[model samples]
Target: MFSEQFNVRFYETDALAHVSNTVVAGWFESGREPIFKLFSPNLDLRNWPLILASYKIDFHLQIFYGKPVEVRTYVSRIGNSSFETYQEIWQQNQKVASGNTTLVRFDFSSNKAVPIEAEIKSQLQEHFYPQQESAK
Candidate 1:
């Protein structure tokens, strides 16, 4: 798993004085850039698009402004044309929220889903959960 630290900003807070749910989602997406780069350094978000097919976030605790948070992400499952990412947001060592996202590989030129590349799968396998049995 890879983790990144982010500070809650004043503007990200809602009228209730807590970080908005949308802001938390943005942080999760931002953390994914580096992980995607690990598989393809030249990954062009404009050319090679990965679309979010589904997402779920469970809010455990409220996050306020100025709190230090860590966003940790890992590849939990990889399928023929899609993958699942699991993420958690921790505040002061306590889990504030956890999320799961399903992303589908796409062929930009064809504007349709495509099977995941073998090379990309191999790279992602290196970061797979330790307890997961190796893919067949």
Candidate 2:
């Protein structure tokens, strides 16, 4: 699992003083940065290889500013051209939300989804969900 800590910034809060629902998506994406680097450490900014295909988020608790939020991300499923990322957020030791995103590997030049490379797949396999590891 890849995990990161984030602070609930004042700007991210709304009139009700809760972190905006939209903000959790950014936090989740932030948690994916390290994992993305594992796949493309030398990726060119002008031509990106991965793009988010879809995502779903379920908010279980509200988040407030001035405290740390913990996000944990993991590889859930891998296919020919796409993989699923499962992520969860926690604040004060309680689960704030959980979500998943589907990312597709693409050939920047072709501008279409492409199969995941063998080497990158191998690296992603190392971070598979624990249940997935047990299944194998």
Candidate 3:
């Protein structure tokens, strides 16, 4: 798993004095930076295009200003041209939010989605999370 920390600044708080909904989304996106680095140390957007297809987040608790938030990310799944990222936000050792994002590898020149490269796939495999079996 990859982790990053962020402090809840006053500007990130909503009128209710808690971190805003949209700000939480930004935190989840930030969680992907390290995972992206695994594929290309210096990701060149023009050459290797990636597009976010969708994301889902469940808020478990409120995150307040001045508190430190930790975001943990992992490669949850991989496909030919798309990959899934799972992330959790922890504040004071408690899980406050968790989510997943789907990103598709794209070819800007061809104006279409492209298959994930072999090298990238190999690196991503190292970070895949173990799948959990569903309860009957």
* Candidate 1 clashes between residue pairs 3 or more apart in a chain or in different chains: none
**Which of 1 and 2 is ahead in TM-score?**
2
Tell me the tens digit of each residue's lDDT in model 1 across 40-89: 57986667658889989999999989878999888889999899888889
Among the numbered candidates, top TM-score falls to 2
Where in model 1 is the C-alpha error above 4 Å? Answer: 130-136
Model 1 lDDT, full chain set: 0.84
Tens digit of per-residue lDDT, candidate 2, span 35-135 = 78866787567767889999999999899899999999989999999999899999999999999899999897887889998888888888888978898
| Per-residue lDDT value at 49 in model 2 | 80
The lDDT per prediction is 0.84, 0.90, 0.86
Which candidate gets the maximum lDDT versus the true structure? 2
TM-scores, in order shown?
0.88, 0.92, 0.90
Which regions of candidate 3 are displaced past 4 Å?
Answer: 132-136
Clashing pairs in 3: none
